[model samples]
Target: MTALPDDLARALDDALDRVPASRLAPVVERLIGDYRGGVATVSSRQGPILRTDDDAAAYAAYRMPATYAAVHDGLSRAAEVVGRLAPRTLLDVGGGTGAAVWAASRLWPSLRAATVLEGSEPVIALGRRLATGADDAAVRAARWERTQLGAATTLPEADLITVSYVLGELPEPVRETLVDEAAARASTVAVFEPGTPAGYRRILAVRERLIAAGMGVAAPCPHDGACPITGDDWCHFAARVDRTSRHRSLKGGTLSHEDEKFAYVVATRAPGQHADNRVLRHPLQRKGLVTLRLCTGDGAIADRPVPRSRREHYRAARDTGWGDAWPPP
Candidate 1:
């Protein structure tokens, strides 16, 4: 019942084997307490999710693993996906803990340089460590900062720009600023978030802005106009993370939660670039296979993906003008 990738699975296994799982929890508990008490910070670009108290909001938000193996795994998966879309230099906006930067660094010859923009003290310190190590064999050096996203911090023209699980904390204006920055330099921008309505909303806003700027959707098109999710809930999807080194310490001896379930929007800079990642569409399998899609109150389609009927599908494609469009069905 584990959802870890090969590397993360082995790392967590080793940690669990070396340190008794039972004993490790306590050690981690203390670490968490210390982290909360201002001794150590998780180094988020956002303000102290955990202050000098014995309770850290960052850990609590992520359910605080004993180690950060799973964190690294998630970062690597995101990095790989984003790298394929825009593989040269990447700008990791609001990069915290440096895990994402570390992941991007592992993309072989694809990744050139990773410039991290952060605004927190503890996180900047950790980023410094990761960035330095990344510099030694890295084709391009790594850089970390304590700068705000809205500051005069301008980045060079990058191939890919990433803002993963970091924008919800910012105000709407700042979110727009980030989208604008991504649009300015990178040929493609990726916005990944937890699978929540709020997350969907954020991606939607980003999708609209980028598309208006002559960009095109690259992933999670959600062709439906409205949220496919029903009963006022939300939509989520799963992505398995492969760990590099720190996997075992955080994931424990066994995996409890599967892969992190988050929604992502990969929008291309140029309009026609959307033609990538497609295959010929074919008829549904299982001869009488019935599919259901969700529809909105106004008969519009929903963007939220929930299990519904073909009616739901019709509403979405209709509203979005998908019309069984070009690349695939």
Candidate 2:
């Protein structure tokens, strides 16, 4: 589970306080509709979805926590491999409201510099305001550049680059170009998307492009040959996000927490310690047996059952959760 830092959460709360939820509810609803209906076309001329300050506020209040949680989970997995590398800089493309920047700063305190590239003026304004309250100096001073994604776009060099929840909005060519540019510019790149079938497809495409760009798959996949997942299934994981009062109110939900299901891929110039097998889902525990669905190093999905007779392995299995590496690495 990943939760927003207290300072970041308070900053968001304070920002939301400036605008009443009652005034932002309809804007949030419209944004939700735009998300569901697809906000962008292949044409680069299409403007950003967030057109007003209220729209940006609604997004920051309602969507930032979930996006932050998802990006944090993805970055944690990446850190499992690249923690020792000690990345010192970050570049967040399409970083709406700096969610990815906050997640990165939370994971890698060594980060001394960060740059955010976003297209929307209102989104950038709100992002800059929220960043002023960030505890991480790098995040607070991050440069919010107004750059649109297209064929002619060039990415800045950084130790790490993150693209989250933005690829699905662009055309295929633009997405491919962005990934290729990131691969060329950064030592590590992490991309995140919603855990839908379509989102999974985008991630798969990104994984392929990254591999083709001479980078190694750093997390999720142990080997870089081919993805084992086939048919209707897709590779994704869930992060539990603790909702704030404002979050719940904006979302109109009673649940105190929500699971943010996400699909992501981390590729790096240098390979890290890849997991032997990744637990694919929540372990099913029976009276005396635990069943584990694993994606193995050889690119195959298998169900491994641990019975009580095997005390050591059973106990380990009992303690394991979804998205963990098997054998407790």
Candidate 3:
């Protein structure tokens, strides 16, 4: 269908620059190398999608900015919704170029240190470039903290832990371990998935596991004890990313192509840590014309801003800004 929203088109034009293609090239190759190997071709609305086997996966990885940002924004907001909770340490699992971590850091400057834990040499190397400060003489020998996560190992207990857009990528057993770890160690945990039905199912699975373990349910409010809103509706939010800094290849005027949508759940072990849906509902839901539901037994509803029409309402979904937003400065 359409590619992205108009605002996102403008944002990606700049934001992609931050992770320069020159930098992304190598990392993309590594991340997709195995999956693409021996494949003759891949298909999409983007034409033949030609690749000589080895290049397919890398190419696919490059095509995923919208999907990546969708889940990232969902988790980032999870951190923001509860900022009043004052978490001291923030841990980003499967951080990926530190996108979500940087998002949280900006919202919670009180954070002592932000640790982005990821595996993947080139990608993590790219992440280090952004989070690690200026380098110099003695610092010349310095290296960034990029570690491989394992089932046996224990992550340093933190007030917040986020595993965004990564559940789909992990093996079943490892995913189980990561979830269990978050339940035991983190004060709050938020995870997200695309708004697709399959994604909603996965988020539900996660919600059940975490709640069973004692964490309180937060987003996508559990409707009558069931999640994902019973209708064709989805829990989605838009992230506005600055364009030029992100490096945009080409634009077709409006970002009719970029639409990032996802379902997210926020859970916390500590009492009073859950975020009231009102803070978020005010921004996304329509006032008077619309209603808000915390996805709970009560299914609370309230008035908020709703776009002029269904079309405009859909268009208003915006989130992160790359750095500079429009017209590529």
Using lDDT, give the best candidate's number.
2
TM-score, one value per model: 0.59, 0.96, 0.61
Measured on C-alpha atoms, candidate 1 has an lDDT of 0.49
Point out where model 1 deviates above 4 Å: 1-47, 50-86, 105-108, 131-136, 151-155, 222-235, 241-257, 270-329
Tens digits of per-residue lDDT for model 3, 262-302: 66677876554333332223233334333322333345443
Q: Model 2 over residues 200-284: C-alpha lDDT tens digits?
A: 9999999999999989887777778788899999999999999877777777889999999989898888656477788999999
For model 1, how does the per-residue alpha-carbon lDDT over 1-329 read when each residue is reduced to its tens digit?
11323332333243335444454455456644654453432233345443321122233213322113333333333333333553667777877645455544554456777777776765555445434433324412667766766634466677777776667667677788788778878887767666666666777788777776666565544232333445665444444443323334443535434455565666675433322221112212333242223232332343333123556543443333111222222
Model 1 weakest lDDT span, ten residues long: 275-284
Candidate 1's TM-score reads: 0.59
**Pairwise TM-score winner, candidates 2 and 3:** 2
1 versus 2: better TM-score goes to:
2
Deviation of model 2 at 103, angstroms: 0.8
List the lowest-lDDT window of 10 residues for candidate 3.
320-329
lDDT winner, 2 or 3: 2
Quickly count the clashes in candidate 1: 25
Task: Quote the lDDT for 110 in model 2.
Answer: 90
Ranking by lDDT: 2, 3, 1
**Overall lDDT per candidate, in order of appearance:** 0.49, 0.87, 0.50
- Give the winner by lDDT: 1 or 2: 2
Point out where model 2 deviates above 4 Å: 40-46
